[model samples]
Target: MLWGRIYFGVQAAAGAAWWIAVAVSPFVREVTLGGLDPVAVAAADIPLFVVGSALAASGVRPAVWVATGWTLVVAIALAVYATVTTEAGWGALVMATAAVASVLALCLVLTGRVPTAWLIAGPFSFRPALPRRIAAAHLVSTGAQIVVFWGFFLVVVPLVITSLENRWSVTLPFPSFVPVVGAVVLVLASGLGLWSGVTMSVVGNGTPLPAAMANRLVIAGPYRFIRNPMAVAGFLQGAAVGLLLSSWLVVAYGVLGAVLWNHAIRPHEEADLEKRFGDDFRRYRDTVRCWVPAISR
Candidate 1:
């Protein structure tokens, strides 16, 4: 029952992310055009919308990857064109927003790849009784993510961009195809983060924590590279958001988020796992660096 709820929650969140991206992309383009017709701009996105919808419905890994890759490629190309040809006013802002929105949309497609078995298996299959403190922590962490990413990164940073444009003078140098390159990187990073988070959440809830909580670690997919790929990916996404908006404050906030996540949240979660998993947990911890990628044992 708990697993079902978690699965649905993840699905709902993923869907919302994609739809929000779709809605926002046009708005950003409109801002760039300065009240020009949005129909032409939006028409270009029809293929992306159709592909994304198909991936969601089919849930095939190859289709998801192909759709996501195409979206990223096209978005990046558009961003490059905008950067090179358009002036550095509302047009730049619009292009940057579009890039970020495309990245977020890619994330949604990646999230759909989370395995179905994880959703079907009840939480109790892993933990007969979830500790109250751990459950509370997970809830709080998820809530914090929503608030920080949506409220601060998305809303506040855009407002800051507007304020800076209106009040402060700023200049950014872009290489010939840098905008497109940056767009591609942003999409890939965001997609990886989304995939990692969805997978980790399933592992966190599905795996039986070691009595010491150290040994029952997941070592597949992105986890093969890093102990906390999800968190690292999230940090990257946040940094990209800061860069896209050209806001140092947002960047600082992203840094602060990483610190808080590592120091406060990760520790508690680790302790819970250790208590649950025991010596096996220690073995896994010893083999894996918390965030850095290492050669798998």
Candidate 2:
């Protein structure tokens, strides 16, 4: 996960910068929100950002809850600031965008739809399991999805992107009601993403992470049709992020991500599986396209 790492890293940087901008800089304090004090606002934001950053960096669930809650706070504060002053600031809208992403991410995580740890893009802990520990295992899996996938993509990415572009004060074009469509698409993508994870956990007696690789080769349900349904889900959700925010920059970010994953990550992952599963993986690879699904498999 190049995506996961950059996403969380950006969030951490943005949160810290925002706090500094509001608290340490007197010019920012006096100038923002038509001269209204941003001191209290910055004070409340940094803790959630810090905690969310730490948990998300480690791929844990509390990160999702904390990030979502903090973004909501940022949105409300921006709304209040807008009402008190006539000057339109980009910061509030940025926070609103973050709020949308956070909420969307939370919805997917709470569904228990996927064993999310399986989706983490980078290196992470993947413990082996015993039968009796299955109950606890499921809980841990759900938490990983919330923290890693949900928190990183939705909250962290947006925060980092906004900060890097220095676009908090710049006005951009956004269509009305786009977020509604984005949400629906995100939900659908998440459902597709989770299907395989659920199968791996149920049939393979394991999650999708390499260290906790599934005990069985899953050849049922969606796996029968496409080799990488999870990638499909991730692609959709990634585009939805740009759609929801109406940011071409972020949209480009998501698209480039897909290209890199296709050319770089997928090949390495498949080779590993081929070495692990041998002929079984080879037959499946030949029968099913990496991305395209069979018509009626």
Candidate 3:
């Protein structure tokens, strides 16, 4: 695909540039690995340069697989080390940007085509389980997911982005009412999310994760009015968090999530639903709007 090729090209260029910088530039060495010896830093980045070049040159399956694994490892290592050890600075920004780019490149490589079937097997499987078991699974999964989401998105990401903004001397001032409004929206959105989770667990007999999605078609509660209340609430919550933090990057991240979900995820999900439920899903989809909440016929 065009996008996959583009990403591969960019990754190759970036990998080569990084290696060259580390070899020749003391500043790059200091910034990349917290003042690691230039020799070691250069050696560490050799794999990055090699894998990227091989993948770009060959465009073969083995090269692609190797590049994917290398990039994933690099991304995870940079993210973990930077978040844990580094203070807010150019180093942090550089590492964060590289990590994000690596992740994007991975996604592009893995999902070469539009409307990937990645979520098909995970969410579409449904076996009839007792209501109590369903509730337990829902509670456990939902709680764990909530912790992971809030810890990463609301706490860690906002902190990093806001620190960068401050370092760059970019200020966005809003009225006192902004935080108040954000707080209200956050609360309301969280409430809606919880209600939607409960409804899914009780009525649909499943949790929200695609791997453990509700077995029954969920049209009760918020799903009755909106096709995707959880998604709506998530967007709202993310935006509200950005508002509270006064971080434009965080707000953009939230918007990006919505865009990705709408374009990449929703199609496969609805397609799976249509395939599984056939006319029932088609009728529900025809009656209920995707974004707007209204009385369903």
Candidate 4:
């Protein structure tokens, strides 16, 4: 576990230190590589890296070796780029992070500890242990979610507003990168969505998909506080994207989508759940709020 511990530990520390260095710098907003901001990139990445580091540190699997190695490479590349391009520089903290990450990567890789399957699959393959059919289904469902919801609805449509003349559509102007307000919303919603997916797999013994729904009831994680955490996350994500892009039409679509789900889709899904789960579903549903979280529940 020496390779896993020291290597991934450096990666985790580097990710954190880079963020800190960027945040405290005078040109915080100017810390972009291309057109993309590192905050958003870090927001997506830090969680996965942290999880990988934790697993590696605990010697859970050899997957962390690959994760750490890849992360180290990325950190080094970014550091090199920052050193070359920026006038302000990455500072002493980030320089130390880069140095440590490089050394760790060499140590992990040179020792022949990196697993091939982990390189091919990932540091954390969610469906690798599942049956082929289940894995395929999960991939299809996840692909649809990324393509339809995240790529098309959240990104493409919102970006369209940039070319238009009118700035306002029908948006409520919510969930922007405005201080901690939007960050908090994004973090909570993303956490809930991830929690629901993980809960479906673990507690319910299946992936989160209507077509291949969980066989058993999943009352763990966010499901303990709210019945439909994924839906809540979806709504928040959509709204956040709209607000971030200054597109009222996108926000309107989000609000309308929520309404449709509540009125049209929810009842049918609930009925199906009731049929499948019987009194257990009823009791849980009765205790848990559909939209809002009751933290104590």
TM-score, every prediction: 0.41, 0.53, 0.61, 0.48
List the candidate numbers ranked by TM-score, top first: 3, 2, 4, 1
lDDT of 1 at 29: 40
Q: Can you write out model 4's per-residue Cα lDDT over 1-297, one digit (the tens) per residue?
A: 376466666566665665676568646535334334667866755665655555555554554654556556656655455444442222322333444554445455446443223322332222222433354455555546545556666677667643321321112444445535545666777777776776766666566656556667889888888899888888887776655555555566678779767865677678778988899999998899998899877
Off by over 4 Å in 1: 1-182, 201-216, 295-297
The predicted structure with the larger TM-score, 1 or 3, is 3
- Measured with C-alpha atoms, the lDDT of residue 124 in candidate 4 is 29
In candidate 3, which residue pairs get closer than 3 Å at backbone N, Cα or C atoms, i.e. clash? 123-210
User: Candidate 2 on 13-40: residue-level lDDT in tens?
Assistant: 7777766776676655544444654555
Candidate 3 lDDT score at position 33: 58
Which residue ranges in model 4 land beyond 4 Å of their true spot?
Answer: 1-148, 161-180
87-177: candidate 1 lDDT, tens digit per residue: 2245444334444444444444455322323322443122422433354444444445545565665567656654555432234443555
Best by lDDT: 3
Q: Model 1, residue 262: displacement in angstroms?
A: 2.2
Local distance difference test, candidate 2: 0.65
lDDT of 3 by residue, 1-297 (tens): 456656666767776777687678776666665644556645655665456635644555455556656656655665555556562234445545655554555556557554445545553443333455447677776678777776787678878777756654344677777778888999999999888888888788877767667778898899989889988898888889888877776777788888878887788778877887799999999988888889634
Steric clashes per prediction: 17, 2, 1, 1
| Poorly placed runs, candidate 3 (over 4 Å) | 14-47, 50-77, 80-178, 198-221, 245-265, 292-297
